[model samples]
Target chain A: MIEQDWIWGLVGGLMIGSAAALYLLVNGRIMGASGIIGGLVDRSGWEGGTERAAFLAGLVLVPMLVVPLYETVETHITSNLAVVIVAGLLVGVGTRLANGCTSGHGVCGISRLSLRGIVATVFYLLGGALVMALARHVLGVI
Target chain B: MLRLLSALVAGGLFGAGLLVSGMVDTTKVQGWLDVFGDWNPTLAFVLGGAIVPMAIAWRVAERRKVAVLGGPLPLMTEGEARPGRNLIIGSTVFGAGWALAGLCPGPALASLTFGGTGGIVFVVAMAAGMLAAPPIRARLDRMQPA
Candidate 1:
């Protein structure tokens, strides 16, 4: 089962990479979800607002169209409401402050071997592992 | 219009990829992150799969001055590649949040149709966080030496 999961993960990841590659090669954009949405929110890259919007619209709507064809998407998000909100806020602010997220830094940045991307990936993984240890083990809050 | 279409296609493909890849499943993500528990190595494959083609794409992009749609490619100039405090601090915070929620922007948004109220809450709150960032960034910039 885990091996099957790995196969799907890899195949899916390939699709993601292709999508990003297309974004870069065709639209000439990084295809970072946070950066694209953040640019719109902060109004920093308003020049490309329409393109971003188009992309987001597709991102949102396409999944809706595809989901019905498969089994339901399941998530094991924390049951605690406060945890959810706080986590959301942190993710929000952190990605913006860091200037990228998994898509930008993790995928795009790392592929380019950009120093910022590599550094950010390391910190985020470390932070995530530490928090997971504390929250799930010590605090038992999440 | 062509550029917009291309963006739409890319976005759709990305969302589909997330769905197909099992990335939309928080349990899978949390499982992957649960290094202390029944750790799943699925995401590692995903990352490996994603990086290979993108690495190739970067190589292809190296020779291009403009995008297929005539837009400038987002290649970094030497000045933009520097690592800094923001990268470290911000990613740490983001990772903590990710660990707690088991979702990031891509999966968060892609999960909207089925992620229920939790997804909605996450997305709205994330937007608020994004909105809150510029002021914080401005302050950070001020503190930096000229």
Candidate 2:
């Protein structure tokens, strides 16, 4: 069995793209999760703090309302606290350093055909694959 | 007010997409990353699906000077869009972390409402990491040749 819902994935992706489009066309901003949050923390992009906060609030709150209507959301996060913390820190720092993430780079960046976005996406995906292979196959750590 | 509302709407939809597309599911994400194992291609679909509308949107943006809400659009200048070492290195590190946890910022936050103590811990630590990034980024910028 495939055990994956490709159709829902497509539908949801369309929604994601639409959200990005709306964000770009209406608010004139890139819908990047890390960029939005990072700006708030570093205080560099404070001019749009309210808008960022609103978007974040929506990201945090809307799931609460909608997730309950369907099957429970599940995660395969490791049980190791150290691993979780380290991973979180890495992601936070990494996205900031890169200036984008899957949303910005993977979705918006690629769609716009920006070389930077494409390159970043390729690197990240390759990195993820390498780590996944090593961790799962070689070290068996994660 | 309208700007805030638009942001909220965009965010809500984005979160919904993550949830509906199963991007919030760490196992699925990890599965996709597991090329040598039983790799799942759901993520590819999600990416493909998201790109269609966004590609159209960018085309729409190309014609407009300002956003509907009267804000300046994020249209890039010629040289400003170039990829650099930071993007490569940072994305590499991020991918490693993502492979480890199968969680990214968006899903991490969206999962917060139900991700329990573990989720809280991750978000807090991630926030700290984000706060730590500015100094690190500044240092990297300093190291670059003028």
Candidate 3:
């Protein structure tokens, strides 16, 4: 896709990993994006609300500041209105039900070799691949 | 103070990484998932690279009870670490959504500053889902008892 995408991907990956490491080592918390946000949504995270709020503020704010620096950032996300809504709903429910998302399970969970994390990662990847094949190749909806 | 600061810094760095790694690009994410079609292997590098430092951090964390800033580490007990039905079902469902939109929670939030109306819609829906999950989960647990 983009030129040298792999290089940028690698560099970005290191930054993410370093962030996770810093969160773990310094804060003593798993840097799971879903858990942080979901906790607030369900009101289960009220006890530690300030920290979660602060984290989310940065999560949202940093991109605002940094994205302007780039010439362009193309997401290529689906434009179909219904698809967007449905996908969003599913992502929310699935991640909450599973008790983690890509960050919590994929990066943080798997890093610690937790069975729950590993299993979730495998299943999600499988689910994603199956849906991709069906929707893109067969149905041609998204 | 330290806790909040660390979270802020960590969150900032994580957001930047998502942007830099091109994880915010739905096409790149979709291309990686499109294994049978024209495959893009860039995401693999992102995953592999992220795992390296995190794996090391886990090891380093294992030897310590408290974090460097004096907080309780996320110590997973045997029960907490085990996989269950919800984990399987939820992950699969999440995957379907990810495939549909080519964005996950991290990328969804990271892209919000520049993601336009679609990003806003997705985040809102995702938040709704999160709000509804507890009751649904409670019912499911009642029915399944597991």
Candidate 4:
């Protein structure tokens, strides 16, 4: 698993890291998903509606485009869609609370050397890890 | 004006690549990771998809001598270099956290968008952790020299 996964991890990591690096390289902006989405939210913030719409729309369509290629994709967990909706809401709350989401704090923020970004990323990682550990190891439930 | 437009254009392309590569799928993500049980090399295709366009982009951007977005072409991007104990301690703590949670910020967002339980949990926990940092930083900032 480790051997086959190494490249996958690299690809995943590279897929993210390189996208980030290039985004930063060309635009001088961090490709933080949360911030972009945040900008897409209500009209209260600095992000204008049109750009936000475009950004949010792109995110939605990206996944749908891939469905045709991978003919036999399988999903293991199907407990409830309600859980998924709640989770999305919770994430929205969290990203707002943290001032940025994973892409913002975890990838672009860190790459740009923002201390706040670093701190947010730490929290993001630790929080996820601890919860994962509890879910899998402690609770013994997935 | 153009900068945000450039961001949208670049992001759109990136999103398209993600779709075509199947990197957007959480099961495929985990499946690729489940190498020990039933190895999957599908990610290689994903990598190729990303790299091919990126390589072209690099060449084109170089030739153009200006960003597709506005602003001076970014020349240097050196991350922080602080000489202090605090930074080291902080980085270690963060790395430990990343190793534990496979979902980093970007992937976590991608995962959550796809409606994965673990991804949801990860995003929630991460937010809680970060929300707890500001007051701490305020206090630390008061201690640091200008």
Q: How well does candidate 2 score on lDDT at residue A12?
A: 90
lDDT of 3 by residue, A52-90 (tens): 888888888999998888777777777797999999999
Q: What's the lDDT for residue B124 in model 4? A: 64
Rank order (by lDDT, best first): 3, 2, 1, 4
Candidate 4, residue B75: the lDDT equals 27
Deviating ranges (above 4 Å) for candidate 4: A25-28, A72-78, B1-5, B16-68, B72-146
Which residue pairs collide, candidate 3? Answer: none
Ranking by DockQ: 2, 1, 3, 4
Predictions in order: lDDT: 0.87, 0.88, 0.89, 0.48
* Global Cα lDDT for candidate 1: 0.87
In order of listing, the candidates' clash counts read 0, 0, 0, 5
What would the per-residue lDDT of candidate 3 be over residues B1-146, giving only the tens digit for each residue? 88898899899999999998989999989998999998899888888889889999888887786899896777643247368888898999999999999999999999997898999999999999999888888998999966
Model 2 chain B lowest lDDT segment of ten: B73-82
Question: Which pairs clash in model 4?
Answer: A1-B35, A1-B36, A32-A103, A32-A104, A102-B105
Ranking according to TM-score, highest score first: 3, 1, 2, 4
How do all models score by TM-score? 0.96, 0.95, 0.96, 0.56
lDDT of 2 by residue, B44-146 (tens): 9999999999999888888896899896777743345468888998999899988988998888888889777778888888889899887888888899931
Candidate No. with top lDDT: 3
Could you list the chain B TM-scores for each candidate?
A: 0.91, 0.91, 0.93, 0.56
lDDT for residue A116 in candidate 3, whole number 0-100: 87
